[model samples]
Target chain A: MPRFNAIFFKLALNSLKSRQGSVILTLLAIIVSVYVLIGVEQIRMQTKQNFNSTIAGTDLIVGARTGDINLLLYAVFHMGAATQNISWKTYQELTTLSSVEWAVPISLGDSHQGYRVTATTPDYFTHYHYAELQPLQFAAGQPFEDVYDVVLGSEVAHKLGYQLGDKLTLSHGLGATSFSVHKDKPFRISGLLQATGTPVDKSLYISLSAMEAIHIGWNNGANSNAAHSVIDTQSLTPKSVTAVMLGLKQKTAIFRFQRVVNEYRDEALLAILPGVTLAKLWQITSVMEQSLRLIAVLILISSLLGLVAMLLASIRERQHEIAVMRVMGASPWFIFSLIEIEVVIVTFVGYVFGLLGVAMSFELAKNIGLEHFSIHLSSNIFSIDQLIYLALILIAAMIAGLIPAVMAYKQALGVRLD
Target chain B: MKTSILIQNLKFSYSPQSPLILDIPSWHVEQGERLFLQGPSGCGKSSLLNLISGILPLTQGYLGVLGAQLDTLSGRQRDHFRAQRIGYVFQRFNLIPYLSALDNIRLACIFTDQQQDSKQVEDKACSLLISLGIEQSHWHKASHQLSVGQQQRVAIARAMIHQPQLLIVDEPTSSLDHQSRDAFMQLLLRQVESTPLTLLFVSHDHTLSSYFSRSQSMNEINDA
Candidate 1:
């Protein structure tokens, strides 16, 4: 039986070699679809992981009444303008509560060359966490010391070509082409944070006093003339904060504390469970994954149909060669098995080529995903699911091969060798 | 003495509704006898060969080859019997065009139940190619790249590689001119004489019968 298989393998190879052009073209289709399927799956998983790890360690986020995802998008991600700011008196009162261990007030609504500028106390760095409570680490220098000292996120420093002691003025608003620059109170880069593969990588951190000093003369979102305003950082205080991230002293008191802030008598403040809100944001990103998978599945179906078409057409051209073999002592089963094995070989080879291509392309995507989106895209060559896909591709290929195999078998049995 | 073929009241038709294509009252060929049968095209010559080779079913006949009744054997058994004891050289010399001459000959050994080491199969192929006047230069070339004469020799070598007992040559020299035809006939006669080969050479050309040990017309025996 093994010897018969050996002979059949050679015969199949001879047949494929005779039609190398069509065989290679069919293989290319399989390779491309495989690559696309694996690529989309990897990117989907990476994006999910990135979105999930964006906020951690904070039990509740206190913002003005807004949507859960909206609060998360603006407060944690610095994506949009907050509709209302939390009163400083309310933040101070919230910190005094026995259930609150720490409250880090964050102020946004400023930009420096497209990077959001976040004004917060040094406590923000000590308590803030991401990716399983992973603490923020500095790549160079310490956190801000003087009011004019600023700390740059890893991406911000790397992208803007800034080093410690380089001074940069903040823009009045969040636009990249802002004309209202706060040139009077320029802040020097005091530190640089390590790349965390999260939203923190694209932010500029500074003390709340600096934000107040920069906007001292600004009115109605415009930088006022400096002729009468030389206010010192010590004399000004942040009038309001965009949101406050709270960590509970007792994890069990989180619900009670959130209720106290949500129904506070002084203002219309909203407190949300960060975990639940981040999950809501993740739903939007998952839609991207579904669309990509749908496209990949469509491509896979087309390629498989193409594979079946090529094999069926080849069977018509191979009737003469098969008749010759049947007379040369090859049985009908031999001819049938040859066609099946030929398709299997093509699928296996195309799968390997596609896998290699995916690995190479993802190697580049990993870096791009990190630098641009702060998403840690893994470049794992062959995950278990990918192996399952490989098995499925081969099985589908064998099933597709059966149609042509039956045709060839019938021809072999019916051919007249005269 | 064992008979190579025995037939009595054999009848064959493509389907039940069609007229019989082959009808023979009685026929026999002793073992080791060389029989050359000639007939015009479409005269049931190919049908008779198909029945003798067990390619067609025999439901109403006492057809036997080498003491085994072909009518009693199943389809698969007949296929194995043909592959084991019969080698056929077709009219068109249908060698796999892409395979080398040696590989084409080795394909015969692949279908047999007998196992041969690679060295043994290679040795046999080399000897057959050499004896059949296939030179070293042409043996390594692809079957299609060889001249018509070389391809014919390769096909014969392939058919004889398993050393089948009954060798059937169907219009082996129909494509050749007189000079090359004489050369091929000389080579085929010389090769078969050395083995205990029962040759059944079929062709319409009667001039070649002078070289065969036995000669008869297929239509004379087949009454349809």
Candidate 2:
């Protein structure tokens, strides 16, 4: 039986080799569609993973009154400037709440090169956790100690080619091309953080007192050197900070803490649950995801149809071949199975090549996604969903090839063989 | 003499609504008989051959081949019977174009009930090719690369590879010249001398009738 099957396989292989041009064209169509189908799925999954792992181990993020998503974008992601800053007095009072175990005040709205510069106390390093409550580890030195000390995230340090003890100044605004540069007080790079595969990898960390001291000799986003003080790290205290991340001693007290923060008497602050806000963000972008899904499915269907059409066209040309095989005692089922074997070979090869193509592109684009977009695309591309898609593609190919196989079977059974 | 084929009250048409194309009342051929049947074009010769080879069902009649009642067998059984017992050769396009001559010959043994290893099958093919006067250099070349006479010889080799009991040749000499046709007929007759093979040769030209032991026109046999 094995030898018999081997002969049939040889026949199918030779038949495909005989019609090389059409076979290659069909293979190209299948490869491209597989690439697109698997590519879209990988990106969708990686993007969701990147979003989910941004911030963890924190109960609530308290920021000035704004939309929950907006607060999340500015406080956790540092994507945009806050509408209003929380007063230092209000933050101090919030940290004193009985349920609050730890608090980290972060002051945003500064830039170093193209990366965001976040100013916070040393407590930020201790309390911050991400990606399954993994603590941030230093690749070089310790966290910021003096007012002029600074730390760099992995991507920021790598892209800027900075090392320990290197001094770089910040800009007053968050644009890539900032007009107001703070070149007066250059901060030393005290430490570098290992890659956490999160937005934190694209940020520069500095002391909050350094943030206040940089603005001392400036007014109204302009540098007035005439009234500039020499240097004062002692009286440098931030009057307002962008947001505060809080961790409660008890997980059950989160809702009550969020209510207390939201209904605060002194300030109009809004507190948000990060996971709920992330779900809302997905809902807002679900339409784009659905459209991409539809496009991928359409391409898959058309390519499969192209494969079927190619087989159907070959059936007409193979009529003589079919007649010859029939005269040699080949049954109608043999003819049918020959075409099916060809389809299986093509689809399986096309699927493998498609996966290789995706992996190669991921290798080329890994650094760019990490450095620029702060998205860490992992190298492991296989998932349960992708395996399911492979099975679906194979079944679809077999079902599609059935049309031509049946045609060839009927032609073989036709009464014309001399 | 042992009967190789028997036909009685055989009736055939393409479909129930189509006109009858063949209506043979009775016909029989003995074992080891070299019979030459002649008929002009469009005289139902091909249809009669189809019926005899089990390619067509016997709508009404008793048709037997090699002692097997072909009319009682199912379609798949008929196919198996043809594969195991009968060898067919066409007039033109006799070989699969893509396969090499050796592969083409070996393909004939795939459907039969015989179990032969690859080495044995390949040796059989090589011996048959050598006997048919096909050069060793041409054995591995694609069937299309061979000349027309060479292809026909290869077709004969393929038809006789499995050592069938009945060999059906359909106008295979029409494309060959007189000398090659004489040589081919001589070779075909010599190849079957070792076994008691019943050979049925059909053609439109009657000049080749001298090569057979008996001759009959299709009009004398088919009563359509």
Candidate 3:
């Protein structure tokens, strides 16, 4: 067997050298498929990591009765629409829970040109944490204390090109198409938060009372029989809020506190553990993730089939070569092993190239995606998922190569000296 | 002396639609015997050699080579028997184009578990090439770089490198010119005489048969 292996190695090496062009082309196909697989995996892992870390230090998110995914979407990502609003009385009652250390109420359902407008108290700036459990730090000015003061997230300021003391108007709805803006009640940008590469980087922060004050005039306008009216900021009275972010006194009592908040009789409100909600969101998205993984596996399988076809197609042209080897005392197994070794070599080369391709893509994404999307592509190469992908590629290649190896063995067995 | 190859009533057909091409009643080559078998193209000369070397299975009769019954052995066992005992040299296009002459010779050694010194093999290959009138400079060149005559000599060296008990030559001198063909034949006969290996040289040209101890035609054997 060792003697046969020596012959197999020499033959496989010589055959690959002779057919360098076809071998390289087949390898290139494998490399492209492997690159796509690893690239998608990296993006998926990093995006999930970014989403999980978007609001790490916050313990619970209080909102109206909804699914955990919906709660996470509105509270953490500021995506989609909130189904219901929590009354002022319910918010005040939740703060009195035994496990509630500090609670910051937030109001949503407003926008400033694609950026979400969040209304909360001064505690938002003091308590909100992002990646690495780091508190929000000011880039220029202080938090929004006055009713007309607005604190902008780093991306909001950079994208809108707003600076300190720059006056801005708010829109009534959460979309970019909001027609009614608070033209008469413009707010000055009081501060800019440093970039955190989280959803917070795209928010416009103001006081909850400010959000209520803006809607106060509209509430009275509905009774006065006007279609819609923009109220002066000074003439409005603050009322309701959208949701609240709760920080627990003890991490162990999060579930107990959530149960108490959910049973609130004053309003139909819900309190959710942010981590649990985020995990539920991940579960919902895992279907799409699994589909993406399946597609990647299919691509890898097709590439390996391409390898087998490439080898099998070349076998006819190499029959004389096989016959020569057989006459020289090489067994059929030797020929089969020769073909198998060629595929193994090609797969190994392709795997290396695939890794390099993924690394290069991440480097490109870090420079561009992080600046714009606030998503940092991690540079770690030894991720367990990636190792699994590599192992999968190897196993798939071995299985794929078996077809041609068997064909070679059969051909060698049938060879005749005549 | 032990018979290196013995065949009784061997029958073979190329395809199911075709009639039998080889129908030999009986044939035998003794050990150390150099027999020349002459037959025209398409007369199943190569088929006969394939059957004798255990490459092609006998359909109708028994074949025994080196004391092993070819018909009783499995395909794998036949391959093993051929590898361990029989050596074959083709008419032309014998050497692999990518491998050097020495590597071509060393390929045969790769099948056996016996330990062989690379230096001794190299020296033997060099001497074989020298004896076959192949220059030392031409030994390292790829098979395609050498002339037809030089390639035939390399093929001979490859076939005889392992000193197999039986050697089968398939019209090896057909591509050589008259002078080179005579010289190739002389070198081949001298090598066979030096070793106890049986030689079966197949060709259509009967003029070369006078040099061998015995010569026979396919018509005399097969009555085709």
The local distance difference test score of each candidate is 0.85, 0.88, 0.82
**Candidate 2 structure quality by residue, lDDT tens digits, B105-124:** 88888988898887998988
User: How high is the lDDT of residue B161 in model 1?
Assistant: 86
Q: Which of candidates 1 and 2 is the stronger one according to DockQ? A: 2
DockQ each: 0.48, 0.54, 0.48
Worst 10 residues of 2 chain A by lDDT: A1-10
Models ranked on DockQ: 2, 1, 3
**Window of ten residues with lowest summed lDDT in model 1 chain B:** B50-59
lDDT of 2: 0.88
* Top-scoring candidate (DockQ): 2
Kindly indicate the candidate among 1 and 2 with the higher TM-score: 2
Ranking by TM-score: 2, 1, 3
Q: Which window of ten consecutive residues has the lowest lDDT sum in model 1 chain A?
A: A1-10
Task: Point out the worst 10-residue segment of candidate 3 chain B by lDDT.
Answer: B107-116
For model 3, the TM-score of its B chain against the native B chain is 0.93
- How many steric clashes does model 3 contain? 0
> What is candidate 1's lDDT per residue for A285-345, written digit by digit as tens?
6777788899998897788778888988988777767766767667788788888888888
